[model samples]
Target: MESETKQSVYHSATYHAAGEAIMSFKPINEIHQHLCAFHVYSSDHSRHVEAHHYCKHLSKDFHQCVIYDSDDPNARLIGIEYIVSEKIFKSLPPEEKKFWHSHKYEVESGLLQLAPKSLVPGAATDIAEQPAMLELHQTYGKTIHTWAIDVYPDLPLGPPNLMMSYIGDGQGPPAEMVQARDAASGQDTAAKRELRKGYLSSYERVEAADEWAKTGRGVEFVVKEVPLKK
Candidate 1:
Protein backbone atom coordinates (compact mmCIF):
# COMPACT_ATOMS: atom_id res chain seq x y z
CA MET A 1 0.00 0.00 0.00
CA GLU A 2 2.90 2.39 0.83
CA SER A 3 4.56 1.65 -2.53
CA GLU A 4 1.25 2.23 -4.32
CA THR A 5 0.86 5.62 -2.57
CA LYS A 6 4.42 6.60 -3.60
CA GLN A 7 3.67 5.64 -7.21
CA SER A 8 0.48 7.71 -7.13
CA VAL A 9 2.44 10.76 -5.95
CA TYR A 10 5.08 10.30 -8.64
CA HIS A 11 2.47 10.11 -11.39
CA SER A 12 0.30 12.93 -10.08
CA ALA A 13 -0.45 15.87 -12.43
CA THR A 14 0.78 18.33 -9.81
CA TYR A 15 4.18 16.65 -9.66
CA HIS A 16 4.53 16.74 -13.46
CA ALA A 17 3.51 20.40 -13.57
CA ALA A 18 6.22 21.24 -11.00
CA GLY A 19 8.80 19.47 -13.15
CA GLU A 20 7.72 21.46 -16.21
CA ALA A 21 8.07 24.71 -14.27
CA ILE A 22 11.69 23.91 -13.43
CA MET A 23 12.51 23.31 -17.11
CA SER A 24 10.87 26.58 -18.14
CA PHE A 25 13.85 28.59 -16.85
CA LYS A 26 15.95 27.68 -19.87
CA PRO A 27 15.71 30.41 -22.50
CA ILE A 28 14.28 29.26 -25.82
CA ASN A 29 16.76 31.02 -28.14
CA GLU A 30 20.07 29.70 -26.80
CA ILE A 31 21.49 28.08 -29.94
CA HIS A 32 25.28 28.25 -30.06
CA GLN A 33 27.91 26.27 -28.17
CA HIS A 34 31.55 27.24 -27.47
CA LEU A 35 33.81 24.77 -25.73
CA CYS A 36 37.23 26.09 -24.72
CA ALA A 37 39.85 26.53 -22.01
CA PHE A 38 40.78 29.58 -19.97
CA HIS A 39 44.00 30.08 -18.09
CA VAL A 40 44.10 31.55 -14.61
CA TYR A 41 45.78 34.96 -14.90
CA SER A 42 47.79 34.38 -11.76
CA SER A 43 48.79 30.83 -12.67
CA ASP A 44 51.47 31.95 -15.16
CA HIS A 45 49.66 30.13 -17.94
CA SER A 46 50.17 26.65 -16.52
CA ARG A 47 46.64 25.75 -15.43
CA HIS A 48 43.91 25.42 -18.02
CA VAL A 49 40.34 25.59 -16.75
CA GLU A 50 37.83 24.00 -19.09
CA ALA A 51 34.69 25.96 -19.91
CA HIS A 52 31.53 24.74 -21.63
CA HIS A 53 29.53 27.69 -22.88
CA TYR A 54 25.93 27.73 -24.12
CA CYS A 55 25.31 31.02 -25.85
CA LYS A 56 22.32 33.01 -27.06
CA HIS A 57 22.42 35.58 -29.81
CA LEU A 58 20.84 38.62 -28.22
CA SER A 59 21.03 40.44 -31.54
CA LYS A 60 22.87 40.24 -34.83
CA ASP A 61 25.90 41.80 -33.20
CA PHE A 62 25.92 40.58 -29.62
CA HIS A 63 25.99 37.32 -27.68
CA GLN A 64 26.06 36.29 -24.05
CA CYS A 65 26.97 32.93 -22.53
CA VAL A 66 26.92 31.20 -19.19
CA ILE A 67 29.94 28.96 -18.71
CA TYR A 68 30.07 25.74 -16.76
CA ASP A 69 33.04 23.74 -15.53
CA SER A 70 31.78 20.70 -17.42
CA ASP A 71 28.62 19.37 -19.06
CA ASP A 72 27.89 16.54 -16.65
CA PRO A 73 25.17 16.54 -13.97
CA ASN A 74 27.68 17.68 -11.37
CA ALA A 75 28.98 20.56 -13.53
CA ARG A 76 29.69 23.73 -11.63
CA LEU A 77 28.81 27.29 -12.57
CA ILE A 78 32.26 28.79 -13.12
CA GLY A 79 31.97 31.92 -15.20
CA ILE A 80 30.32 34.07 -17.89
CA GLU A 81 31.65 35.03 -21.34
CA TYR A 82 30.49 37.81 -23.65
CA ILE A 83 31.13 38.06 -27.40
CA VAL A 84 30.74 40.78 -30.02
CA SER A 85 31.22 41.29 -33.72
CA GLU A 86 34.32 43.03 -35.05
CA LYS A 87 32.35 46.21 -35.78
CA ILE A 88 31.13 46.34 -32.22
CA PHE A 89 34.60 45.54 -30.94
CA LYS A 90 36.12 48.46 -32.83
CA SER A 91 33.55 50.83 -31.32
CA LEU A 92 34.67 50.10 -27.80
CA PRO A 93 37.13 52.41 -26.02
CA PRO A 94 40.71 51.19 -25.72
CA GLU A 95 40.27 50.44 -22.03
CA GLU A 96 37.15 48.39 -22.70
CA LYS A 97 38.78 46.60 -25.62
CA LYS A 98 41.59 45.51 -23.36
CA PHE A 99 39.11 43.38 -21.47
CA TRP A 100 38.44 41.27 -24.55
CA HIS A 101 40.53 38.58 -26.22
CA SER A 102 40.74 37.39 -29.80
CA HIS A 103 39.72 33.82 -30.75
CA LYS A 104 42.29 33.28 -33.51
CA TYR A 105 44.61 30.85 -31.79
CA GLU A 106 41.75 29.17 -30.02
CA VAL A 107 39.94 28.42 -33.27
CA GLU A 108 42.95 27.69 -35.49
CA SER A 109 44.73 25.42 -33.02
CA GLY A 110 41.54 23.47 -32.26
CA LEU A 111 41.70 24.55 -28.64
CA LEU A 112 38.18 25.89 -28.93
CA GLN A 113 35.54 23.24 -29.65
CA LEU A 114 31.84 22.63 -29.78
CA ALA A 115 30.12 20.96 -26.86
CA PRO A 116 29.99 17.16 -27.10
CA LYS A 117 26.94 14.86 -27.27
CA SER A 118 27.04 14.43 -23.51
CA LEU A 119 26.32 18.12 -23.12
CA VAL A 120 24.41 19.22 -26.22
CA PRO A 121 22.87 15.88 -27.31
CA GLY A 122 24.10 15.94 -30.98
CA ALA A 123 26.94 18.51 -31.28
CA ALA A 124 30.13 16.48 -31.55
CA THR A 125 32.13 17.96 -34.43
CA ASP A 126 34.76 20.54 -35.17
CA ILE A 127 32.61 23.54 -34.43
CA ALA A 128 35.18 25.45 -36.50
CA GLU A 129 34.32 23.33 -39.49
CA GLN A 130 30.65 24.29 -39.37
CA PRO A 131 29.24 27.25 -41.29
CA ALA A 132 28.15 28.95 -38.08
CA MET A 133 31.64 28.55 -36.67
CA LEU A 134 32.99 30.85 -39.37
CA GLU A 135 31.34 33.82 -37.71
CA LEU A 136 32.60 32.69 -34.30
CA HIS A 137 36.11 32.37 -35.69
CA GLN A 138 35.95 36.10 -36.22
CA THR A 139 34.31 37.09 -32.93
CA TYR A 140 36.03 38.29 -29.77
CA GLY A 141 35.35 37.17 -26.21
CA LYS A 142 35.71 38.73 -22.78
CA THR A 143 35.45 36.25 -19.93
CA ILE A 144 35.56 36.57 -16.16
CA HIS A 145 35.87 33.50 -13.97
CA THR A 146 34.07 33.84 -10.63
CA TRP A 147 34.98 30.53 -9.11
CA ALA A 148 38.50 29.19 -8.72
CA ILE A 149 37.19 25.63 -8.54
CA ASP A 150 40.47 24.27 -9.92
CA VAL A 151 42.38 25.59 -6.96
CA TYR A 152 39.82 25.49 -4.17
CA PRO A 153 38.11 22.24 -5.24
CA ASP A 154 35.23 22.49 -2.72
CA LEU A 155 34.01 26.10 -2.96
CA PRO A 156 34.60 29.50 -4.52
CA LEU A 157 37.10 31.13 -2.20
CA GLY A 158 37.78 34.67 -3.40
CA PRO A 159 36.92 37.49 -5.73
CA PRO A 160 36.41 36.75 -9.40
CA ASN A 161 39.58 36.25 -11.43
CA LEU A 162 40.24 37.86 -14.81
CA MET A 163 40.85 34.97 -17.21
CA MET A 164 42.70 35.10 -20.54
CA SER A 165 42.80 32.98 -23.67
CA TYR A 166 45.84 31.43 -25.30
CA ILE A 167 47.33 33.77 -27.91
CA GLY A 168 49.85 31.75 -29.97
CA ASP A 169 51.27 28.37 -30.81
CA GLY A 170 52.51 26.40 -27.77
CA GLN A 171 50.58 28.77 -25.51
CA GLY A 172 47.43 26.66 -25.30
CA PRO A 173 46.54 24.26 -22.50
CA PRO A 174 49.03 21.45 -21.81
CA ALA A 175 48.94 18.44 -24.11
CA GLU A 176 47.97 16.08 -21.28
CA MET A 177 45.06 18.27 -20.29
CA VAL A 178 43.79 18.31 -23.87
CA GLN A 179 44.31 14.55 -24.12
CA ALA A 180 42.40 13.89 -20.93
CA ARG A 181 39.56 16.12 -22.07
CA ASP A 182 39.45 14.43 -25.46
CA ALA A 183 39.43 10.99 -23.84
CA ALA A 184 36.43 11.81 -21.67
CA SER A 185 34.58 13.69 -24.44
CA GLY A 186 35.39 11.10 -27.14
CA GLN A 187 36.48 13.88 -29.48
CA ASP A 188 39.84 14.38 -31.14
CA THR A 189 41.44 17.81 -30.90
CA ALA A 190 44.06 16.93 -33.51
CA ALA A 191 41.46 15.85 -36.01
CA LYS A 192 39.57 19.06 -35.43
CA ARG A 193 42.75 20.97 -36.23
CA GLU A 194 42.99 19.23 -39.58
CA LEU A 195 39.38 20.06 -40.35
CA ARG A 196 40.00 23.80 -39.78
CA LYS A 197 42.96 24.13 -42.15
CA GLY A 198 40.87 25.71 -44.90
CA TYR A 199 39.59 28.37 -42.54
CA LEU A 200 43.13 29.58 -41.87
CA SER A 201 43.33 31.49 -45.16
CA SER A 202 40.26 33.69 -44.64
CA TYR A 203 40.23 34.09 -40.85
CA GLU A 204 41.71 37.45 -39.86
CA ARG A 205 43.34 37.49 -36.46
CA VAL A 206 42.28 40.33 -34.18
CA GLU A 207 45.39 41.88 -32.68
CA ALA A 208 44.00 44.94 -30.90
CA ALA A 209 43.30 43.13 -27.62
CA ASP A 210 46.75 41.60 -27.43
CA GLU A 211 48.30 44.95 -28.39
CA TRP A 212 46.95 46.43 -25.15
CA ALA A 213 48.85 43.82 -23.17
CA LYS A 214 52.07 44.63 -24.98
CA THR A 215 51.68 48.30 -24.05
CA GLY A 216 51.07 47.30 -20.41
CA ARG A 217 47.77 49.12 -20.44
CA GLY A 218 45.55 46.14 -19.67
CA VAL A 219 44.58 44.89 -16.23
CA GLU A 220 47.61 43.60 -14.34
CA PHE A 221 47.83 41.32 -11.31
CA VAL A 222 46.94 42.61 -7.88
CA VAL A 223 46.34 41.11 -4.43
CA LYS A 224 43.54 42.06 -2.08
CA GLU A 225 42.95 41.13 1.52
CA VAL A 226 39.58 41.51 3.22
CA PRO A 227 37.60 40.16 6.16
CA LEU A 228 34.55 38.03 5.54
CA LYS A 229 31.20 39.33 6.71
CA LYS A 230 29.48 37.53 9.57
Candidate 2:
Protein backbone atom coordinates (compact mmCIF):
# COMPACT_ATOMS: atom_id res chain seq x y z
CA MET A 1 0.00 0.00 0.00
CA GLU A 2 3.09 2.27 0.24
CA SER A 3 5.58 3.23 -2.44
CA GLU A 4 8.70 5.33 -2.84
CA THR A 5 8.19 8.90 -4.03
CA LYS A 6 8.52 8.80 -7.81
CA GLN A 7 8.61 12.53 -8.40
CA SER A 8 10.55 15.11 -6.41
CA VAL A 9 12.95 17.99 -6.99
CA TYR A 10 14.21 18.58 -3.41
CA HIS A 11 12.92 22.17 -3.47
CA SER A 12 10.14 21.38 -1.00
CA ALA A 13 12.45 19.55 1.35
CA THR A 14 14.87 22.47 1.32
CA TYR A 15 12.14 24.96 2.22
CA HIS A 16 10.72 22.55 4.81
CA ALA A 17 14.04 22.40 6.59
CA ALA A 18 14.41 26.17 6.38
CA GLY A 19 10.96 26.64 7.91
CA GLU A 20 11.82 24.23 10.70
CA ALA A 21 14.85 26.31 11.55
CA ILE A 22 13.02 29.68 11.49
CA MET A 23 9.54 28.72 12.71
CA SER A 24 8.44 26.98 15.84
CA PHE A 25 6.03 24.05 15.50
CA LYS A 26 4.34 24.70 18.83
CA PRO A 27 1.27 22.48 18.67
CA ILE A 28 2.69 19.54 16.73
CA ASN A 29 5.90 19.58 18.73
CA GLU A 30 3.99 18.19 21.68
CA ILE A 31 3.47 14.80 20.10
CA HIS A 32 4.63 12.42 22.85
CA GLN A 33 3.26 9.04 21.92
CA HIS A 34 3.47 6.80 18.90
CA LEU A 35 0.83 4.09 18.73
CA CYS A 36 0.14 1.55 16.03
CA ALA A 37 -3.14 -0.30 15.59
CA PHE A 38 -5.67 -1.72 13.16
CA HIS A 39 -8.91 0.07 12.37
CA VAL A 40 -11.86 -1.52 10.58
CA TYR A 41 -14.49 0.52 8.82
CA SER A 42 -17.64 0.79 10.89
CA SER A 43 -19.85 0.48 7.83
CA ASP A 44 -17.99 -2.57 6.53
CA HIS A 45 -16.11 -4.76 8.96
CA SER A 46 -14.25 -6.48 6.14
CA ARG A 47 -12.01 -3.47 5.46
CA HIS A 48 -9.02 -3.46 7.79
CA VAL A 49 -6.58 -0.58 7.75
CA GLU A 50 -3.29 -0.53 9.57
CA ALA A 51 -2.79 2.80 11.30
CA HIS A 52 0.13 4.55 12.94
CA HIS A 53 -1.05 7.14 15.42
CA TYR A 54 1.18 10.04 16.38
CA CYS A 55 -0.68 11.54 19.31
CA LYS A 56 -0.58 14.29 21.87
CA HIS A 57 -2.48 15.10 25.02
CA LEU A 58 -4.59 18.17 24.35
CA SER A 59 -5.94 18.26 27.89
CA LYS A 60 -6.27 16.08 30.97
CA ASP A 61 -9.29 14.33 29.53
CA PHE A 62 -8.60 14.36 25.78
CA HIS A 63 -6.06 13.17 23.23
CA GLN A 64 -5.90 13.47 19.46
CA CYS A 65 -3.80 11.64 16.93
CA VAL A 66 -2.79 12.08 13.31
CA ILE A 67 -2.87 8.68 11.64
CA TYR A 68 -0.67 7.42 8.85
CA ASP A 69 -0.75 4.27 6.75
CA SER A 70 2.85 3.48 7.57
CA ASP A 71 5.76 4.72 9.66
CA ASP A 72 7.78 5.45 6.56
CA PRO A 73 9.03 9.01 5.98
CA ASN A 74 6.63 9.45 3.09
CA ALA A 75 3.71 7.75 4.85
CA ARG A 76 0.35 9.00 3.68
CA LEU A 77 -1.76 10.85 6.16
CA ILE A 78 -4.90 8.76 6.29
CA GLY A 79 -7.05 9.87 9.24
CA ILE A 80 -7.57 11.39 12.64
CA GLU A 81 -8.60 9.83 15.96
CA TYR A 82 -9.90 11.45 19.11
CA ILE A 83 -9.63 9.75 22.48
CA VAL A 84 -11.56 10.92 25.48
CA SER A 85 -11.59 9.69 29.03
CA GLU A 86 -14.55 7.81 30.51
CA LYS A 87 -15.66 10.90 32.37
CA ILE A 88 -15.88 12.85 29.16
CA PHE A 89 -17.47 10.02 27.19
CA LYS A 90 -20.11 9.39 29.87
CA SER A 91 -21.53 12.86 29.32
CA LEU A 92 -22.28 12.44 25.62
CA PRO A 93 -25.83 11.82 24.40
CA PRO A 94 -26.79 8.22 23.58
CA GLU A 95 -26.97 8.95 19.86
CA GLU A 96 -23.52 10.53 19.90
CA LYS A 97 -22.10 7.58 21.81
CA LYS A 98 -22.89 5.33 18.88
CA PHE A 99 -19.90 6.66 16.97
CA TRP A 100 -17.24 6.02 19.60
CA HIS A 101 -15.64 2.65 20.35
CA SER A 102 -13.91 1.23 23.41
CA HIS A 103 -10.16 0.63 23.69
CA LYS A 104 -10.26 -2.26 26.15
CA TYR A 105 -10.24 -5.07 23.64
CA GLU A 106 -7.58 -3.43 21.53
CA VAL A 107 -5.34 -2.82 24.52
CA GLU A 108 -5.76 -6.21 26.15
CA SER A 109 -5.73 -8.06 22.87
CA GLY A 110 -2.46 -6.32 21.91
CA LEU A 111 -4.08 -5.21 18.71
CA LEU A 112 -3.07 -1.74 19.88
CA GLN A 113 0.39 -0.93 21.20
CA LEU A 114 2.96 1.77 21.64
CA ALA A 115 5.22 1.69 18.56
CA PRO A 116 8.64 0.00 18.69
CA LYS A 117 8.29 -3.32 20.49
CA SER A 118 10.54 -3.95 23.44
CA LEU A 119 13.63 -5.83 22.38
CA VAL A 120 13.69 -7.44 25.81
CA PRO A 121 10.59 -8.26 27.84
CA GLY A 122 10.13 -6.06 30.89
CA ALA A 123 12.89 -3.77 29.76
CA ALA A 124 12.77 -0.07 30.62
CA THR A 125 10.76 0.61 27.49
CA ASP A 126 8.23 -2.09 28.37
CA ILE A 127 7.94 -0.71 31.90
CA ALA A 128 7.35 2.75 30.48
CA GLU A 129 4.73 1.50 28.04
CA GLN A 130 2.60 -0.48 30.49
CA PRO A 131 0.87 2.41 32.23
CA ALA A 132 0.14 4.21 28.98
CA MET A 133 -1.54 1.07 27.66
CA LEU A 134 -3.54 0.68 30.87
CA GLU A 135 -4.73 4.27 30.73
CA LEU A 136 -5.88 3.83 27.14
CA HIS A 137 -7.86 0.74 28.13
CA GLN A 138 -10.34 2.94 29.97
CA THR A 139 -10.79 5.58 27.29
CA TYR A 140 -12.93 5.65 24.14
CA GLY A 141 -11.89 6.63 20.63
CA LYS A 142 -13.66 7.84 17.49
CA THR A 143 -11.64 7.44 14.30
CA ILE A 144 -12.36 8.48 10.71
CA HIS A 145 -10.22 7.60 7.72
CA THR A 146 -10.41 10.03 4.81
CA TRP A 147 -8.22 7.94 2.57
CA ALA A 148 -9.46 4.57 1.38
CA ILE A 149 -5.85 3.55 0.72
CA ASP A 150 -6.43 -0.16 0.94
CA VAL A 151 -8.65 -0.21 -2.12
CA TYR A 152 -7.94 3.00 -4.00
CA PRO A 153 -4.18 2.82 -3.85
CA ASP A 154 -3.40 5.73 -6.17
CA LEU A 155 -5.62 8.31 -4.57
CA PRO A 156 -8.17 8.83 -1.81
CA LEU A 157 -11.77 8.58 -2.96
CA GLY A 158 -15.25 8.67 -1.37
CA PRO A 159 -16.46 10.00 1.95
CA PRO A 160 -14.52 9.65 5.17
CA ASN A 161 -15.38 6.29 6.77
CA LEU A 162 -15.97 6.01 10.49
CA MET A 163 -13.57 3.45 11.92
CA MET A 164 -14.03 1.00 14.82
CA SER A 165 -11.87 -1.07 17.13
CA TYR A 166 -12.18 -4.81 17.67
CA ILE A 167 -13.77 -5.93 20.93
CA GLY A 168 -14.49 -9.64 21.00
CA ASP A 169 -12.69 -12.92 20.62
CA GLY A 170 -12.60 -14.27 17.04
CA GLN A 171 -13.30 -10.75 15.82
CA GLY A 172 -9.65 -9.85 15.25
CA PRO A 173 -8.00 -9.48 11.87
CA PRO A 174 -6.78 -12.49 9.87
CA ALA A 175 -3.48 -14.26 10.59
CA GLU A 176 -1.66 -12.74 7.60
CA MET A 177 -2.70 -9.24 8.61
CA VAL A 178 -1.28 -9.71 12.08
CA GLN A 179 1.78 -11.34 10.60
CA ALA A 180 2.62 -8.33 8.44
CA ARG A 181 2.68 -5.93 11.37
CA ASP A 182 4.65 -8.29 13.59
CA ALA A 183 7.20 -8.76 10.88
CA ALA A 184 7.69 -5.04 10.47
CA SER A 185 7.49 -3.92 14.11
CA GLY A 186 8.85 -6.90 16.06
CA GLN A 187 5.59 -7.30 17.98
CA ASP A 188 3.83 -10.39 19.24
CA THR A 189 0.13 -9.76 19.73
CA ALA A 190 -0.41 -13.28 21.08
CA ALA A 191 2.30 -12.88 23.69
CA LYS A 192 0.98 -9.45 24.59
CA ARG A 193 -2.48 -11.02 25.07
CA GLU A 194 -1.17 -13.39 27.71
CA LEU A 195 1.00 -10.74 29.34
CA ARG A 196 -1.82 -8.26 29.83
CA LYS A 197 -4.38 -10.63 31.38
CA GLY A 198 -3.11 -10.00 34.90
CA TYR A 199 -3.11 -6.21 34.68
CA LEU A 200 -6.41 -5.81 32.88
CA SER A 201 -8.27 -8.52 34.81
CA SER A 202 -10.16 -6.04 36.98
CA TYR A 203 -11.21 -3.85 34.10
CA GLU A 204 -14.94 -3.59 33.34
CA ARG A 205 -16.70 -2.27 30.28
CA VAL A 206 -18.76 0.89 30.54
CA GLU A 207 -22.36 0.46 29.49
CA ALA A 208 -22.83 3.90 27.97
CA ALA A 209 -20.01 3.64 25.40
CA ASP A 210 -19.08 1.50 22.42
CA GLU A 211 -22.61 1.36 21.11
CA TRP A 212 -21.49 -0.72 18.15
CA ALA A 213 -20.61 -3.59 20.49
CA LYS A 214 -24.13 -3.57 21.90
CA THR A 215 -25.89 -3.12 18.57
CA GLY A 216 -24.86 -5.13 15.56
CA ARG A 217 -24.90 -2.06 13.33
CA GLY A 218 -22.52 0.93 13.08
CA VAL A 219 -22.89 4.59 12.18
CA GLU A 220 -22.09 5.82 8.69
CA PHE A 221 -22.74 8.75 6.38
CA VAL A 222 -24.81 8.71 3.21
CA VAL A 223 -25.52 11.36 0.60
CA LYS A 224 -28.72 13.22 1.36
CA GLU A 225 -30.68 15.33 -1.08
CA VAL A 226 -32.29 18.70 -0.42
CA PRO A 227 -33.43 21.68 -2.43
CA LEU A 228 -30.61 24.11 -3.29
CA LYS A 229 -30.94 27.87 -2.78
CA LYS A 230 -32.75 29.43 -5.73
Number of colliding residue pairs in each model: 0, 0
Per-prediction TM-score = 0.78, 0.88
Pick the lDDT winner: 2
lDDT per residue, candidate 1, 16-41, as tens digits?
A: 79888787655734556555555545
Range of the 10 consecutive residues with the lowest summed lDDT in candidate 2: 1-10
Model 1 lDDT on a 0 to 1 scale: 0.72
Candidate 2: misplaced stretches above 4 Å?
A: 1-12, 117-124, 225-230
* Candidate no. 1 TM-score: 0.78
Q: Which ranges in model 1 have alpha carbons more than 4 Å from their true place? A: 1-19, 26-34, 40-43, 118-124, 127-129, 211-230
| Alpha carbon deviation, residue 111, candidate 2 (Å) | 1.0
lDDT of each residue in 3-55, candidate 2, tens digit only: 33422436667878899999988878899889989999897788889899999
